[model samples]
Target: MKQPLLDMRGIVKSFSGVRALNGVSIQLEKGEVLSVCGENGSGKSTLMKVLSGVWPFASYEGEIFFEGSQVKASSIRDTEVLGIVIIHQELALVKELSVLENIFLGNELGSFARLDDEAMYRRTSELLARVKLDVLPDTLVRDLGVGQQQLVEIAKALNKNVKLLILDEPTSSLTSTEIEILLNIVSELKAQGIACIYISHKLDEVLSLSDWVAVIRDGEHIATKAAADLTQNDIIGMMVGRQLDELFPREVHDIGEVILRVSHATAMQAGASRPQVDDVSFKLHQGEILGIAGLIGSGRTELMQCLYGCYDGQYSVNIELEGKEKAIRSQRTALQAGIAMVPEDRKRHGIVPIMSVGRNITLSVLDNYKALFGAIDEDKESQDIDDYIARLKVKTASADLAIKNLSGGNQQKAIIAKCLLTHPKILILDEPTRGIDVGAKYEIYKLMFALVKEGVSIIMVSSELPEVIGISDRVLVMHEGKLKGDFGYRGLTQEIIMNCAIKEGA
Candidate 1:
């Protein structure tokens, strides 16, 4: 039999006396696609870092055998030289640099004496073509969308002569079309005898793209089986160590009166030919969960931004809040008028990475804890923080820890706590569970139900069709900045929502 391309045995890694990976073992055959599935903080990314030499050889105790030889890599460069490349969850490309420059940034394509621009451009073109991307090499990285940027990251990996490609959450930000394209590229790479290790929280993608499925839970390997023999529930059961009876734990709540009404709302980008959000109108009720569904650039986010008073474009919004007309011009105005939003890109817009957990939670209502002498009341702040932490079940060692140290779900909880502190009548969440694990997603869904029961209205914008149909009281589909259809969840299906989103009309 042919030797396996990679073999890792008894890998043990720890941080500050906490074991991240314990007695984990995995093997990969030539050209095989192995998927790593687990919940948040399950040590999936840590194992990949160990394999790719990000944790280095001396930092962890493990034996990695590649091509019948034991390998000890001290750095990422060493692993890359051995044809083991990792594209991280957070992209590593410099946005200011051109595609050609970002691809060959550290690993330039020329001799020591002279630079070879022509050779690098040619190689970049070929790599882009291999990934089926048609963008020019000179295009700036910042100019591309998240899905396009992901394709560029893959093209960059291909330029490294990658024999073993490791992708961590590559499709987290991609649309359906982009995900299909990326999966096709992975298949092509497999056909060319390139091994891949795909780490993702999206179980459906893992089941579809992998030849071998490996489940890890709490830093331990639970099971590794053939993809054909396993189902999505089987994988989820292994990852969370229990059967998830349902993906959406929806609870019934009594939806009250119409609290918010917007009529003829239009938003236009500066110097643009046409309005991005054109004559959009919607109504949101008290104690209701209203879901907004659309494609990537369907103006769903733009409309939300305009409503939240953060849109940079010129917008005219005629809104009635509880039967009273109001003019909201800025985020401060929106917040003061009982509105709060949790943005889509959590890492970039949600939390202050350097701030402590307690600080992030109480950031919105700091004035409420101020004393007459102008001194901030630490005891009150701490009490409120502790209360919410327990209420939301945020997993953390202490409130003093940096918010960034928490997982995606925990960070989201912190942001939600911040919004709730403002005593907002209306809550807006954009892609609230974008990068969260399955377990965390359930918690958030339950939290939404609890909020609505307390008479708080919610407007959620999400790309996941199942989620939109599962928990939403009603769904509004947008197609090219226009309201295509409004659906009730009773008889709603993904097919109907998608048809409304893609159907052509003025």
Candidate 2:
């Protein structure tokens, strides 16, 4: 019989008065991957925080035994020193720095004297090779797309000679080919006796890669079983403590007249290599979810940006709303025309982190509630904010609390709530659930269904294939600034979409 590499017993954690983890236990064998599967706010991340020392020894009650020795990790550095590394839900690479610099950040070698440029780049190349990423070591982090940046993060962790690697939603942004490469890397790591704690909302990934599956729900451990032993329904039942009827509940609804029409819309940067978004035309019908699916760098985002009037691009547009032609030269114009856009980068573009939750929600609709004398409407504003907070299940101490205090899921919900108040006819959600957890994703899906039922046309651009397939009535696949394929929801498959996205002949 072989000894286990990692063992956590009687783990308990809390935030203020709310218990996040209660008496959870897990075990991992050397060279095996143990997947943690749970809904959002289910304490999977909290348990990982405890193990990685984000919640220090004194803050959480737990016993972590690594390599048959009891260890109390007081800081992230302490855990790192023991060859344990965590790649957080939000990536930690310094955008301004080069790849080599980011990989060696805080964990720099040849430290006391100065940085060893030659040695660092050499090691970085080796690590990159292991991960199947062939980019130059000196490339800036900011220049890379989300998927490429994720590979860089993996390379950074591997550069630490990590024994136990923890990945949170690692493949969320990756393409299918990239996911294959990552899975191969994980298998290679396993061959070398390295262990992994894979945390993800992606069940297929968890089932495919894991040897054991641990389920947690509402701060308590439900069960841990072999990956092959549990059915998909079995896992879901454990996570939510009930059955999820449909991942994409596409209830039949009538598609009315075109609510939005964009003709020959173009967005271009001055003196750049061709326009960011070339001449494009599309129409969205009321009560319809039109999903835009494309690889990163496709013109999908730029088209949405143009529709929302987010930039002063060399722009020429013909747009129609509700049978009337309208000009949207600015964000104000777009908002006035009953269009709302949820930007892709929620933290930077979609939210005001330092602002109070109430203020952030009311920002888009301030004029409607303003007093006739131009005085502020404090009481009404507070009430509206509170109403949204309750409706969206936004977890906040109070409406007055800063937006930065909420978790990623809660923040995303707040953003949706903010947009909902605008009474938008056409809602543009660009990567709406990019960094959100599964439970939050379910909530967003339900919200979308409800909105569609209410006759609000939605244009959603998503990198997630399952999401696009599940929720959309129709999908548009883009390639190299062009629409490559268009299909009704029932007619699309992962294989068909992939072929269209990469097929130059198409």
Candidate 3:
């Protein structure tokens, strides 16, 4: 039998005396794609970190054998020198740098004396061609879209002469077209005898692309099976330790009077030829979960930003809030009118990472805790923060800890708690469950139902079609800055939503 390309045995890791990976083992055959999947805190990333030398040889208990040799790597560069490259969930490229500069940032293409620009550009051009990215070598990273940035990341990895590539949630921010391109690249890499370790919460992608599927739960390896023999439900069962009969836990809520109405809303960029959102009109009902579904750049986010008064572009929105027409000129105006929005980019726009968990949750509604002489009431603030921490089930060692210290799901919950503390009549969530695990997603879904039951309206904008079809009471589809279709979720399917989103005309 041929030796496995990578073998990690008896791997164990911990943080603060708590075990993150307990006796976990994984193997990858030469040129094979092994997918590691689990819930948010299930230790998948920890295992990869151990292999990539992020935890180092002494920090974790494990025996890593690469290419029939026991390897002890003390740093990320150590593993990279051994042909192991890791692309983290967050892209590592510098946005201000050009493509060629970012790709060769650490590994320069010249001797210690001088930099070789021409040689680096030629090599970068070849890498970009291999990855099918059609952009100039001098293009700034910031100018490229998220999908393009991901391709750039891959190109950078290819320059490292990688024998095994580890991708963590690589497609979480990519669109359908970009995902297809990335999967094709993986296949090509496999054909060239390069091994890959793919980690993602998207099960369909896992089952479709993997040769072997490994499930880890609670720091333990649940099972590893051939992809052909396992079904999506089987994988989900192993990840959560229970059969998820229905991915969406639908609950019927009483739909009441119209709580919000936007008529002839339009948002225009300063130098663009056309408006980002063009003459869109929609009505949101009380106790309703209204889902906005569309492809990327279809103006769904722009419409929401305009409604929330956060769009920098020229825009006009005539809104009726609780049967009274109001003009919202800024985010403060929108908040004063009882409208709250959870932005799409959580790290950039949602939470204050350096702030404490409690502070982030109560940031939007601090005025509620103010007492005599404009002094804040510590007792009331603590009470409200504790209430939300328990109510939303945000996992943290303490409320005083920095919000960024928590996992993605817990951080998301904290952001939601922040939005809820404002007591808004209308809550707008842009991709509420994006980048979170399935377990956390279910919890968020249940929370949505509870909120709607209490008469709070929700407007969710999501790129995931299944999520839009699953949890939404009604869905509005947009294509090319136009509302193409609006339908109830009773008989809706993903195909219907996509058809509307891709249709040529209004």
Which candidate has the highest lDDT of all? 3
Candidate 1: lDDT over CA atoms?
0.89
- Model 1 poorest ten-residue lDDT run: 404-413
> Local error of candidate 3 at 358, Å?
2.7
Collision count of model 2: 0
> Each model's C-alpha lDDT?
0.89, 0.85, 0.90
Off by over 4 Å in 1: none
Report the lDDT tens digits of candidate 2 across residue range 1-506: 66688889999887677677899999998899999987666777788889999888879887998888887888999888888889887788899999998999888778768878889889999988878887899999998877788889989889886899998878866777788888888888889999999987778888999999999887798988999997787788888777877776667788998888888877787887867666778889999999999887778888888888886568777898988998887778988999998887786777889999888998999997889799778988888898888887887767887887666667888898899889999999988887665656777888888899899999999988989999999899888777778899896898888888787853
What's the true lDDT of residue 222 in model 3?
Answer: 93
Q: Which stretches of candidate 3 lie over 4 Å from their true place?
A: 371-379
Better of 2 and 3 by TM-score: 3
Q: With candidate 3 superimposed using the best TM-score fit, by how many Å does residue 372's alpha carbon deviate from the native?
A: 5.7
Ranking by TM-score: 1, 3, 2
